[model samples]
Target: MMSAVVVAARAWIGTPYLHQASCKGAGADCLGLLRGVWREVVGAEPEAVPAYSPDWSEPARREDLAAAAGRWLSAESAMAPGVVLLFRMREAAVAKHMGILSVAGDAPKFVHAYSGHGVVESPLSLPWERRVVGLFRFPGH
Candidate 1:
């Protein structure tokens, strides 16, 4: 399953960054990338996502994405490779970013889509670790 995730995520490497979009060989946001991966590894998305703005949770002061993830995915206590990660950019902000843990080791790593960088694998450094608010696994795996 972990290998399946790495294979699927690596295929998104060059996709352009697009807010709220999820299309391989084109554009996708962090969540979009996860959605695409779900389609490949699990099945169709569990639910249709409502349209959302880039700042969807900023003003609401809600962890909408985390809540939604919890509803669909099973949380994992250990940082296992291929588990999904939800991050909060700030202590007060809602959890927003999502990624797949590709390497869970001293030099941990994950794959995600960012505005300027598109899709890329990043080190799960202190800065990134501090932002992690939730951890989940693909269902039925």
Candidate 2:
């Protein structure tokens, strides 16, 4: 199941970044990428996502994304392939970015739809690790 999640995420590589969109090979933001993968691997979304802006939850200092993940995904502590990672871009900011872990071990990596780079695999380097605030697994996985 974990490998299947990784495969589904990798299939979204090269998708253009589009805020609020979730179509593979067309466009997707970080959340959209996750949503796309969920549709492929986990069946329909559990709930509808409300419209959001780029500066989501920042002004209000709310962890909207993390809250949603908590409701629908199983929280986990250990890092492993297929886990969803939520990151805080900066100190004192709400976690808003997310990715699916694709590779674990020495050269750990993750797949995400970066704003400028679109969907791509990135090294889970120290910098990225430091930003991770929450880890989760797909429901029933």
Backbone atom clashes (below 3 Å) for every candidate: 0, 0
- The residue pairs found clashing in candidate 2 are none
- Compared with the true structure, what per-residue lDDT tens digits does model 1 show for residues 61-112? 8778988999999988889788898999888888889998999889999999
lDDT tens per residue, model 2, 19-131? 99999989999999999999998999999999999999899888999999999999999889999999999999999999999999999999999999999999999999999
Instruction: State the TM-score for model 1.
Output: 0.95
Model 1: pairs clashing at backbone N, Cα or C within 3 Å: none
User: lDDT of each prediction vs. the true structure?
Assistant: 0.89, 0.94
The runs of at least 3 residues in candidate 1 whose Cα sits more than 4 Å from the true structure, single-residue gaps closed, are none
Q: Highest TM-score, which number?
A: 2
